[model samples]
Target: MLHLRVVCPAERTEDVLRVLRAAPGATHLVLLRGAALDPVGDVVEAEIAREATDEVLSELCRLGVDHSGGITLETIDTALSDAADRAEEAAPGEGADAVVWEELIARTGEESRLSVTFQAFLTIACLLAAVGAVTNSAITVVGAMVVGPEFGPLAAVAVGLVGRRWDLVRRAAFALVAGFLLATGVTAAATVLAEGVGLFGPGVLDQGAQQVDFVFQVGPFSLIVAMLAGAAGMLAMTSAKSAALVGVFISVTTVPAAGFAAVAAVLGRWDLCGRSLAQLVVNMVGIVLAAWLVLVLRRSGSSVGGRGSRGGRATARREDNGRPLAKG
Candidate 1:
């Protein structure tokens, strides 16, 4: 359920009230008047069910309440009285199946931006990746992948494409590019310094049998794994299965590839550097393609006359038909 708080001019109060009263899922209407302060006129409060939210919001938009006034809608977890009972009866399944794209964008937006938390995560992940490459340990590489904070911007790009929000798309793309360059630069400098101090050697960069596993190898399997991880990552972001997102992070090789490239460059291994760069490209392309596909599927399935919408309406209609008529 959502709690709608509307503040509008006193003159349009009747029109706003009519819109809310006629809305199919609106209940617990509370009207207040004469609270005008600083060009405000009146306020109206109501509780609305989730299924009817789209229609109610659309009506509000049509009424011009959003212009020259204010309308705030906040999700309410609990309520008291018969309205609460009705809300419980009308609630969507487990609250996980519903995809609130706006909310998802907000959450990921907070993560992907160059905030203190983002910088901290990137720094730690890059250091971990550099250490892993120096030691030639796949386990450390995997740990770096899991720790990297690049997934948020990547997912944001996909979501922006589907929603056609160019602002979000631009911001996400900028963040991704900037974050990668920053991480790579930092790791590369660290690698060079470590090598100068005799902590690492040219032997670490050699493509010999001893360090074969550290060499980047791009193949069809790499692309496939990246694509699968990207799709799962989007699902984890949108659905209730968010715990699986960490696994998705570990399954991809983006951060590790960048780290490998930086380290190889420091060790003067051009061949390994080239291969690592290719690996990074392949993984990013695969993940972006997969994320776009997921968004397309979600949009197609949620159209007004599509299966998901129809199913929601059918369920509501069935309940309406069997219920006793209430006095107005």
Candidate 2:
């Protein structure tokens, strides 16, 4: 269940109440007239089931409540009322499986942005991975993977593709391309600087790098593992069980591959560099494709045996089919 606090103008208060009344998921509706000082309107509050959040939010959005006032949502930790149970039962589908599209868009939107902090984490992770590759240290490589923040933008890309949000796709793509380029470039520069000193012995990478060769070897299992991790990542992100993300972070070789590629390029090992980059590409492509598929399924599940507040017209899924496919 979720708690919604709505600030509505006096003229629109009745309309907002009407929406709440119509929604089977809503219960314990409370209206505090003239309680909002900032917006100077009546404050309406209610608890709704997670399964019906998308539909209820959709209706509220259509009423222009968000534009005029605001809508805030919070998870309900506990609701002992029988009304709450009935509301959850009345909502279609299981709350855990429901896709609140608006919430997803908002969450991923922030993550997809190319921020300085994002660049710092990617660069640091890549540099850590480069060090791990040189020393053939599995523990260090795993640490680097955990530190990488690339998954946020990658997941955003998948969500954007499924939601048909071009703005999101563009931003996420830019973040990935620019972030990788910057991280790899910085790591390569650092490697050169380290080599200038006595930091690395001659042929140190060639001798000890075999242990980490899996980072560069691209094959069927590479894509398969990436796809599995991607699916899990999406499920962990979209579902309430976010703790599942712990394993997903280290399941792919994207960061390690980038780090290996950067170091290999600096060492003039063109073959290894190319292979490492291929591994990176394979992992990224597999993750995006798999995540997109999961989102499509979850989105469909949200609508089947459910309801949509201002549904889109049904249309074939096409890249150019910009018309919002009616989401349930």
Candidate 3:
């Protein structure tokens, strides 16, 4: 459910009240008149059902109440009264099934912008991955994947493709490319320095056990795994399921592959470098394609009432017409 707090001018109080009273899912409407200290108006507090939230919010936005005064709505865990039940019952058919793209973008934006702390974490993760690859430690490789922060930009890119937002596409692509390059460069340099100090020996690169599999040796199995992981990753992010996201993180080899490639390059082992680089590309292509397909399916199934739904339909139409989904 959601709680809404609306403050409007006194002159518009009755009009607002009338709208709320007639609204499909509004309940526990309380009006406090003459409550403003700044010569504005009154405040209306109400509890609403989650299913009916979109309708009510749409109505409020349409009424210009948000601009004239202000409208603040927040999700509430507990029901305040029996009216809440009634509100749910009164909601429109099947409720709103829209994707809420703006909200999704905002959420993804928060994830894509790498902070100083995130950079530190990513750096540490890449370093660990490099060390793991050189030492043939699967445990360290998995740990690095858990700590890697590459998924955010990847998710952004997926969303951008589905939504056909060129700006988002550009930003996401830039972030992904720049992040990989920076992480790989740093890890490679570190590997070289480690080799110089005898912390890692030339034999490390020659060990078959330490080698990562990468080649046209790729098959449907690799594609299937990547596709499933990508879908699961997107689902976890959208559903706000953190634990599921952890599983999704470990299921893909993006970070580990990059680290391995960088380490191989530093060690001057062309065979390992080629294989590791191929592995990285395979994982990336599979994940992005899978994520895009997932989003496409989601947009197709979403309700067509909200702006998000409209955007989705538009993107679908574009795809149907052979227009590229992602911006270059």
Candidate 4:
């Protein structure tokens, strides 16, 4: 369930109330006229079924509430009311199976941006991977996988493609490419410096990294694992089961491949470097492809799960042309 807080203009309060009262999945409508000082209007609050949220938000956008007033949606972690129960039952589908697109797009947008924090995490993850590769440590490779933030932009790319958000796709792609390049370059430089300081031997990776050799072993299993991890990651995100993210994080090998590639290039092992690059590309492509496929399936599913959301996005997109599906 989602708790909706709406600050509506004085004249539009009745329209807002009517929409809420008429919505099957909306309950506990409370209206306080002239209670909003900043917007200087009325405050309306209600609990909405997650399955029905898209339509409700779309209607609110149609009324210009999002532009002129304000609307906020919060997840209700522990609502014990029978009214909330009835709201869920009255809605189109189960809450957990529903996809709240606005929330997803907004979240991915922020995560996919090129920020200082993103650079730091990517660099650190790559460095950890490089060390793991030279030392042939699977544990360190796993740690690098867990520490990597590449999934965010990768997810953004999938979400953007699904939602027809070209700008987001471009931004995410740039961040993904540029971030890996910078981190891999830094890792390569570090590898050279380590050799100069006698920290690493000249032929450390010549033995093919016995334990962590899988990082550069590009093959069918690599793509399959990445695809499976991508699908699971998208499902976890859409269903709001964030705990599953840890499993997804430790399942892919993009970070480790980048680390290995950097170290291999520094050691003049072009063969290993090429294979590691292939592994990295395969994982990235498989993840984005699988994630996009999952989102498309969810969006095109049955009315019991996709009715309000599908229609709402279509409706809102039509009404508010080129505005990111109602622009909330």
Residues 259-301, model 3: lDDT tens digits: 8878888878777778767777777788878878877876555
List candidate 2 stretches off by more than 4 Å.
301-328
Q: Mind giving the per-residue lDDT tens digits that candidate 2 earns over 1-328?
A: 8889999899999999999999988999999999998888999999989888888877776787766777777777899999999999998888888777766655666778789999999999999999998889988889899999988899989987876666678989999999999999999999999888968864777785666888998999999999999999998777766777768879999999999999999998889899999999999999999999998888764542122322221211211233221222
RMSD of 4: 4.0
Q: After superposition, how far is residue 72 of candidate 1 from its true place, in Å?
A: 4.8
Per-candidate Cα lDDT values, in order, are 0.69, 0.82, 0.68, 0.84
Candidate achieving higher TM-score, 1 or 2: 2
Q: What TM-score number comes out for model 3? A: 0.76
Q: What is the lDDT of residue 311 in candidate 2?
A: 27
lDDT of 4 at 56: 83
Question: Judged by TM-score, which candidate is best?
Answer: 4
Q: How does each model score on TM-score?
A: 0.75, 0.89, 0.76, 0.90
Model 1's C-alpha root-mean-square deviation from the true structure amounts to 9.4
Instruction: Write candidate 4's Cα lDDT for 198-310 as tens digits.
Output: 99798888766788989988889999999999999999888888789889889999999998999999999999999999999999999999999999898754331122445
Best by lDDT: 4
**Cα deviation in Å at residue 210, candidate 3?**
5.6
Residue clash pairs of candidate 4: none
Model 2 poorest ten-residue lDDT run = 311-320
